[model samples]
Target: MKAWLILLGAMGACAMLTLAYQAGEGVAEHRCEVARAVAKDAARSEAERRDGESAAGTAQLHDNLGTQLPAMEAEAHAATERIRTIYVEAPVSGVCTRPDGVQAELDAARARANAAAARGL
Candidate 1:
C-alpha cells in the first residue's frame, strides 16, 4: 500500500510540473506573437512617415524620396529578411529591435516609390 501511494504521488508531481512547463511555453509564444505584431506596426508607421516626407516641398526631399529612399529601403529590407531567416533556424528564433527599424525603413521606401509612381515620375 505504501509503495502504491509513493508511485501515485510521484506521478501527480510530474503531471503538475509538466503543466507548469507548458504554461510557461504558452506565455513565451504569446510574447513572440506580440513582438511580431509590434514590429509590423512600426514598419507601417515608418512607411507612412516616408510617404509624408516625399510630399515635402524641397528638392533634396524629392530626390531622397525618388532615389536614395528606395536603395536604403532595399538594404533595410534585406537586413530584416536575413535576421528573420537566421531566427527561423530552430533553436534561437526571433526578430529583435534592430530588424524592426530596418523593416520599417524598407516599408517607407515602398511607400515613397508608390507615391512617385502616382506623380508620373
Candidate 2:
C-alpha cells in the first residue's frame, strides 16, 4: 500500500509539472502577441498624427493663396500696363536699342495680362 501511494504521488507531481510548463509557454506567447499589438497601435497613431499635420499645412497654404490671389492679380495687372506703356513710349523716347527684344517683352506682358483678365483677376 505504501509503495502504491508513493507511485501515485509521483505521477501527480509529474502531471502538475507538465501543466505548469504548458501554462508558462501560453503566458509567454500571449505577452508577445500583446506587445506586437501595442507596437502596431503606436505606429498607426504616429502615422495618423503626421497625416493630420500635413493636411493642416496644406489647408493653410490654400487659405494663404486664396487671400493673396487678388493682390497678386492686381500686381500682375499693374506690371502688364507698365510694360505696355514702356513698349509704346520706347520708340518716341528713342531709347529702344533692340526692337525685337522690346517686342518680345511686350508680347510676354500682354499674354500675362490676358491670362489674368480671363481668370477674372
Candidate 3:
C-alpha cells in the first residue's frame, strides 16, 4: 500500500508539470501574436502619414503653378525686349578701332554677366 501511494503521487506530479508547460507555451504564443499585430498597426499608420503629406505637397505645387506661370512668362518677355533694345542702341554702327579703355569696359561687362548668372536669371 505504501508503494502504491508513492507511485500515484509521482504520477500526479508528472501530470501537473505537463499542464504547466502547456500553459506557458500558450502564454508565449499569445504574446508573440499581440506583438505582431502591434507592429502591423504601426506600419499602417506610418504609410498613411506619408501618403497624406504627399497629397498635400502635390496640391501646393498645383496652386503655385496656377499663380506663377503668367508672372514667369511676363518676366521672360521683358528680358527679351531689354535685349533687343540693347542691340539697337549699341554705340558703333560699323566696325571700329579698339578703344583705349575697351579692356576695362569688357571686364565690367563680364562681371555683370557673372553676377546675373549667379542670380539664376
Q: Report the lDDT tens digits of candidate 3 across residue range 4-87.
A: 999999999999999999999999999999999999999999999999999999999999999998999999999988885665
lDDT of 1 by residue, 7-108 (tens): 999999999999999999999999999999999999999999998777665767777689888898999999988985664333243534445466667668
Q: On lDDT, who's better, 1 or 2?
A: 2
Better of 2 and 3 by TM-score: 3
Off by over 4 Å in 1: 57-121
What's the TM-score of every candidate structure? 0.45, 0.53, 0.55
lDDT of candidate 3 vs native?
0.88
Query: How many pairs collide in each candidate, listed in order?
Result: 0, 0, 0
Residue-wise C-alpha lDDT for candidate 2, range 1-121, written one tens digit per residue: 9999999999999999999999999999999999999999999999999999999999999999999998999999999889867755555555546656776786788789989999999
Error of 1 at 109 (Å): 47
Candidate 2 lDDT: 0.89
Candidate 2 TM-score, C-alpha based: 0.53
By lDDT, rank the candidates, best first.
Answer: 2, 3, 1
